[model samples]
Target chain A: MSKLSARSEDYLKAILRLQDQKKVVRVKDLAQLLGVRSPTVVGVVSGLKEGGLVDQEHYGYISLTPEGKVVAETLLQNEELLRTFFEEVLNLDSGEATQNACNVEHFITPRCRERLVSFIRFLEICGRGAPKWLDHFRHFSLTGEPPPCDRCGEIFPGDRRGCEKA
Target chain B: MSKLSARSEDYLKAILRLQDQKKVVRVKDLAQLLGVRSPTVVGVVSGLKEGGLVDQEHYGYISLTPEGKVVAETLLQNEELLRTFFEEVLNLDSGEATQNACNVEHFITPRCRERLVSFIRFLEICGRGAPKWLDHFRHFSLTGEPPPCDRCGEIFPGDRRGCEKA
Candidate 1:
């Protein structure tokens, strides 16, 4: 199948979320959730129907085809993962993280996503009770420079570049 | 200014790169570089001209206005940072990193960009001679489980969950 546009993916994801929250989804529900008009929802839903991504039945109730469900679920997963990474690992505020995740979810590739999952997992395991290096990282973020110890050859003797390696 | 479409940003970035490499830019050169046709370039260039992002004069030679150059430069920097993060921090192959970087750069926000910068800087500083946690991460990636030491209460005493902290 061809890749769905970001707008289409948003519709799919919104539809899936509505499906999760309620038994029946109407045009107005999706439109309200997406902050668009009913006519706009009608137009996009028809396109999605043509694309085999959704089914409209029973007086405007919307349902996802199996493939559509899969696509929507994947995008939802990507969005959640990005939100977690941004909020937990990147330490951005919840709103900032949500916004960034929404922007990035469609664009991040599967390989990058896999790597991200692993990075988070690594932190979960290796950072039990929060590792000391994490504090060092926080310091670096605040100062825009590595701390005095991580800067020189102290950590790795004879590697003189220190924090200036870049 | 309003946000440019991804297509418009592509045109602007392509112009910047071509400008960096040579003195003059034509629609054909842009089309060749972008692997699109000249007519498409002409159409988009007209829109960009109206937006004050570019100028087409002296037989189709293209030049970015100051604002256009700033926008293009920011996009270029975002792309490079993403490429470096994917390649160095994520350990993705060069080609995969480049492809993901290209897909992600336009959508990433300035705040998210700052976090990514800090993350890379953290790695550069704290990961001198490769942190052991990163090695554990590599192991986790290959085996889909943290190593024995990380899985128990060894790293952090009384923490029985160990690698299962998630």
Candidate 2:
């Protein structure tokens, strides 16, 4: 598949979100959701239509093609995974996690995204009720000092760059 | 700071990388690095110059302004952090990690980047010489069955979506 620009992907995602919430999508709704002018939405939607990712009525409602739906779902899945990682693991506020996830979603490749999914699952399992590193990360974020690793003799702040070698 | 398009950020990063390796940045070099035509590089560089992010000596050599250098460094740092995470923690091949990191760097916010840095440090300290989850992730990638998390009773493939609750 050809790579779409990040902005174009954002448009696809917004269209999907608007459709889900309102059960219909229009140029005005897309513009409002994306915080852009109506003309910009019109232009991008027309481009998406030409690319066979969307369909539109005669100057009316917009809808995703099957291909577009797949693209939107993938983007949404990535955003959700990242948001969950940031909020649950990193302990970021929900708003910050949502914003960061939105910003970062377009960049993750399918291959990398698969690994991320598995990694998230790993964390979920390991983090349930044991000596979870997720909590350790949250503590480090709060106190700028990472908890010591008994496995490795190197202290975190003291070793700093040398930690990479460990 | 005004937001630049992903394209613009890519251009800035390309120029910085070319300058670091070749000691000079020309339109052709940028075209080759970005896999775009010289005309595209010229157009983008012109916009960069207009935006006060770059300086071109009579349409010959291109160099970044001080402001542009700051932007480039931030992008570079994000890429490095991601590349290291992918390669070191996730065990992706170096080339794949670098490529994915380049694609994803511009989207990470500064605050998120700081957390990532700390997270990497935490992993380095905790993962060394131990039954590290980093190695466990590589195992999951290969076997497709995640190593069990004794704390949670959820098995990965069987409880795909429900793993989140675990």
Give the number of the best model, judged by lDDT. Answer: 1
Candidate 1 clash pair list? none
Give the lowest summed-lDDT range of ten residues in model 1 chain A.
Answer: A151-160
Per-candidate local distance difference test: 0.78, 0.76
lDDT of 1 by residue, A45-137 (tens): 988998999999746599999989999998999999999988887778898998888878988778889999988777666555545445566
TM-score of chain A of each: 0.80, 0.82
Model 1, residue A120: what's the lDDT? 79
The residue-by-residue lDDT of candidate 2 on B54-123, one tens digit each, is: 9998867999999998998878878889899878876778998998888778776777778878888876
Scored against the native two-chain complex, candidate 1 gets a DockQ of: 0.34
Two-chain complex of model 2, DockQ on C-alpha atoms against the true structure: 0.27
Those runs of model 1 whose alpha carbons end farther than 4 Å from true positions after fitting are A129-135, A145-166, B129-136, B145-166
Cα misplacement distance, residue B84 of candidate 1 (Å): 1.0
- TM-score for each candidate, following the candidate numbering: 0.84, 0.79
Candidate 1: lDDT of A109? 77
Best by DockQ: 1
lDDT for B163 (candidate 2): 42
Task: List runs of model 2 lying over 4 Å from the truth.
Answer: A1-4, A148-166, B1-3, B50-53, B65-67, B148-166
